[model samples]
Target: MTSITRLFDFPYYQQDKYISIPDALVTKQNGVWVKTSTEEYISKANAVSRALLRMGVKKDDKIAIISTNNRTEWNIMDIGVLQTGSQTIPIYPTISEDDYEYILNHSGAIYCFVSDIEVLRKINLIRNKIPNVLEVYSFNAIEGCKNWVELLKIGEDETNQYLVEEQKNKVQTEDLATIIYTSGTTGKPKGVMLSHRNIVSNVLNSAPRIPFEAGKSRALSFLPICHIFERMILYLYQYYGVSVYFGESIDKISDNIKEVKPTVITAVPRLLEKVYDKIYAKGTELTGIKKKLFFWAIDLGLRYEPYGANGVWYELQLKLARKLIFSKWKEGLGGNLDLMVSGSAALQTRLARVFAAAEIPVMEGYGLTETSPVISVNDMRNKGFKVGTVGKVIDGVSVKIAEDGEILCKGPNIMMGYYKDEKLTSEVIIDDYFHTGDIGEIDAEGFLRITDRKKEMFKTSGGKYIAPQLIENTMKQSRFIEQIMVIGDGQKMPAAFIQPNFDFVKEWAKIHKIEIGTTNEEITADPKVIARIQEEINRLNDKFGNWEKIKRFELTADIWSIEGGHLTPTLKLKRKIVMEKYIDLFHKIYN
Candidate 1:
């Protein structure tokens, strides 16, 4: 830690130090992760830079990537482009056609390093329309595109001294590193222009607060690095020399965890929630006594606090409970997850609490793409790990509540502005303080808790403001409901649009002899199924007033997913899209 005279003087040299970040690479050779030291990384990065120059990449040019978690190729291209004083444009593999087109056109990327031919097919859909794209490079052996191995071979003259000089002099701290487009569920994806300072500043500012150790902590990355939440952490890992293992996919994350045994990783709330559901699913498959104790241990972890009620013996029992029950969860996470930091969305407090009680530190943070994606994070060493709040602002960041209740932030982490969209940029970033759309309040201890989005708040016909997220969080506590969206912008009372946990409902239906071969529409329309869902909704509505209570509800057969057009890449509901698409059903319910 550098000695600073005042507490607020931290993060002063992050941008300066990032220019000095060591060039180290972690490569996968023969299935074993090998650490290529700083010298080797620079050599490889220089080689890649030489390759890009040979490919006619110019200064301030844009390079695009379409892949999941291939850190090898992703980082190489990222650093290689930066070495040429160029920007990298990353597109999420799961982004819709609208966002993909917006990112390509918005980023002004002239060349692309696509992962395979499938992505090329997507590019071919609108390639003629996108005039900026000059060439496309594929990572694997694709028939029509330039291959990765072949591209690297082009710059194979490792003795190219000019490439080395290019790495040293061409890049600067304030140069554009990446032009990230945010997946705005309500509107079009906006390209967030991040400079080397914006991203490196975020890494240096956040890395210390997180529990990380060079050559000690490893991470299994399955989360899409196209977003800043993952990209910032990726840079933080590079800065700290934390080895990263790319999980084959979401399905293989558990198997990879056992193999890599990572000490730290980051995730969104949905992934963690699924893990919790799986544990219970596995528990239900066990024999009588074991199953009973499994559920008992989990129930205890969820309900019990760190401080025991009945003194030493009770505390000892709780310890036994942890060893017997929750230890498997710790093992499931590769037996060494010191902390799992969640961002990009709000984490349910109940889930966060249970994970913390299980001895796995669940540090949830809050930020938007506009702030280089990190404004605040809970520290493992601090007492401010409140379940509801997104911790305090990182050491040097200044945060204040606006009169309208929007969270306003000012720091080095704040972005320069939205690229090419001056009118939209002016609406959010004012006088260097970025107005976060979320409505939040700082506690007496300075921890910030977001109530809901300022724009997400709606009104009933009676004109009483209703925050759907608050009710949705409360309703999600039930095991029966998997996903819920509350609606009542101009209606008499709020009503819920619900999706049930299919596996749970199907099993329950089978046990009750309620034949489950019906389609989603028929299943939701079934009298018995309707009664059960209504029972669950009514149980939740008991806690609310007539204005807030769900007056009518709907259970759809379809799952809300990124591919299904109901969710954003980050798993946030496209409320406007969903409402409009299902408007007829909503209207029929009220009529």
Candidate 2:
């Protein structure tokens, strides 16, 4: 039994704890690792808050932060902003210039903090257009701009420490702490106003459910801090005094995990899928008994059930399999990882089951930015952890399936409203229930299984409704598919645009003695390649209904990406953008 006492109401969690712990919070500066103790973090944050106050920043003022996860500074600035009763507006540094201008203007942010030179350049590009933004500060000490450290130095005062403490006490739980602008798939981003009460409610309610040791557990923070999921989880980690090591970059996470050997981590499904694919690719390289054993271990894992025992003989084999294969699998994720938390998208059930069986448990969860980011999560500590579902509705939250199957949630975690968009907010919130726009069903066991996005479901000319997400998820199970989009709204039949897994296809072609051309265009146009992809599509078609079956498909060499505007930052497909970009491919298939 773990000895972590969970809290139910964390009103002044960060303010109180940062003072009490006085322990190190790790960060990377340049190429060296540095530890800023909690006391140092609090002092720096207070000094910065005083600097902002000196610069005429008042309570309820909107301050914006456009940065990647520069761990120490990000957390300190957030604390500073909130302590002064100013709301922080976090924007993804990768956002387009237009979005940057719009968000800054709409939020009326008077001061902005940027991460690096490029981010500073982006702000300067639109500085004149966004008239309300008074000044830009950099996390990095770039030329001609105020740096965050300077703010701390400018306002540092030993005598005024009591005033900072008073400021912390003055903050009410109901005060607005941040306005998070969600870059959703379908439309312009909306500013989600989350009060201190909203986020603290989530932290307190959701923390006890996650099984982690207080002082023993360590987490590798790599996900974007601008995301509420990561931010909320950070607060939970702080509450438990869990040591956190920030990854240098997204590309460096694997290396960081091996070095840090963290016990916990959070991720989106895309990252997990990539990890699964990498593991599967490694299995293909083995020979004879080793290859057989590798696949056998995976098969056993996929058959694993959390709730029911698989008999003594089966358990014995599982133990052997764990020793021979799964243990090494855990080593790849850093030997200490007990479990992982997956959110922002639905995890593939196959991957979920296989990982669970491999002893590297993945607790899949579900929610949106509006609900403090977590509405339900599978508790891996419990026997009822189901692979296909997002687990049960969390405590302090109520979920209902509407007549049309949209998931409706009523919770204290729900956003106060869309900032400056009352009419838009009213459309989604009715009588205190927030319409989640996701179509899902709750089982008798209380597991919530999300099937499709209500807006993404479409009908064919034959009047058959097809859930594109269902077909897409099934198609992704194929080894050749890297990405796929299902299209047929008002058309005679469904068609698909698929991006093939280049590395897998190259390896396969070499083994089969098929010659693919050097260029992507030539490779995609190859008859053998097209024929092989079609065969995989045909196999998947057997699993779907007549209307949902993909009758034709066009293979593409191009992988969809955030920069390409075909995918959101979370990797959810921008269907509308994809349709526009590939209209010629769809025309070729349909016409």
Candidate 3:
């Protein structure tokens, strides 16, 4: 039996030692669900390796993959590149062309594979700028562009299978597997160099935490495969013989979930927030008894305690709530979503409680791309689950809170270092512990609770330190605020630039018979809307210390998005970019 030490060994191990499912990987194409059996997946990946070898791909060669959505092709290509002892550079498709140029050049990627015409076009715009990128291939066949199928066709001869094997044998568990450029909120994206051991250890260690039913478990993967969180989970799925289905896109996830009926999925907090908001909006449209029951269930869910800590009467009420209201919530999310792993940012505790109460457990985890992503995750078994914390540190990983409160981690999962940036890497990884730059604490029970980003906490002019993330998370519980950034560094008081939840605000306007205008600018400018948002802030402010309360706020007319240069691809706010974009509003709040 092949040991799962290297990233490329996962599929082979699954096929030889585990159940080989006919639907190991499924992707929607032209409105039809296409299945790739474990046999076909391995065969195709082998062919990709042979083709790359034939094309002169050598050890340490870098290959860039830029995809608009998660697909089987990306996964196959990933394994293929790894088998050749080459590094896979996964780039986010939503980033600016300048970023595309920077990553390709910085990694010296010899060849680039794109998922669609749009990504190809972006590459075409800067083809000349990145001199090291030898060629560009598209997963989707495009006129005048090289297609990935051409490589598969070249490898169909199978004459060079021995060469593929030779290279695969040369690959080591500690060898660099991928260079994932972090879509950071500020500055250039850092290429996080992760080894096969870094990720394989994470998958193996994190697997026991997730209750997978082996071959019977199904997962709908919609998160970006470029990110280690999703990419590592894909390997874990393969390792556990879980059938993986790729959602068509973010907009079509609802429909795809119903079609796939996956037993589990991974998501970011922002996506979960949107899902909850959509469901809550629908509940508000209910009438009389149904409406009361819906809100009652929501309130009950917000107060949920795991392990029946709320006692037998509360458990009985929760049972009734699940049947009467929360059951529909489960059904709406495919009726089979038993677990969801939330990461990449802080998840609202209310959101976590409500979803778990609905019987769809969302296990929030914490890690950076450099750590192969999973350091700790909330697990349900053996009192391992916690309501607000990120759960206990995974097996084989050690975490300690620094005197300054930054979470320091040392584990097999930690990256080798940032690519070609030894000076920068030295500053973060000290005494074998990676300074996570996240302020957090381990409770007496061993649950890790993240408080804020080390650099994001700011001091008011009066010398009081304010952790904006805690305040922001609390404020976002309101249905009115969609996005917010608290800005008050070196200022007299803390203030915020808020992007209202337009959909919910419109619904609220209808309920109140208020005549707020149609456009975002007009709605933000309306005194009634401003006053109502202020009321929400005032109510939630009591949760914080006097120095940390939001003293003033200004609403933004436009939504903050990745394309708008206000958020990273991971959906974290680009604080510098956001502040620059909302300078006028910032001045209005402080002045």
TM-score of each: 0.91, 0.95, 0.99
Model 2, position 170, has a per-residue lDDT of 72
Which regions in candidate 2 have their CA more than 4 angstroms from the true location? 1-24
Candidate achieving higher lDDT, 1 or 2:
2
Predict model 1's lDDT versus the native: 0.76
Per-model lDDT? 0.76, 0.85, 0.94
Worst 10 residues of 3 by lDDT: 12-21
Model 1 CA deviation exceeding 4 Å by range? 1-40, 304-314, 543-546
Candidate 3 global lDDT: 0.94
Model 2 residue 390 CA deviation (Å) reads 0.2
- Cα-based lDDT at residue 143, candidate 3: 97
Separate clash counts for every candidate: 0, 0, 0
Tens-digit lDDT string for candidate 1 (1-591): 433221111222222233322323444445776555444455556677788887777788888989855556776666666777778888988776556677888788898888867787888788887889887788767887887666568777866657646554756667667788877877777888877777667777887688776545677777888888987787777656566676667777788788878888889988888888888788888999999898777776666443343478656766887888888889888899878999988888878778887888788999988888889888757465777779888876899999989899998878877889899889998988999999999999888898998889998889998988888977877767888889888888788788887778787788688875657767777778778878888898888877788888888777878888888888988998888878877887777
* Residue 478 in candidate 2, Cα distance off native in Å: 1.8
Clashes (candidate 1): 0
Q: In model 3, state the lDDT of residue 365.
A: 95
Backbone clashes in candidate 2 total 0
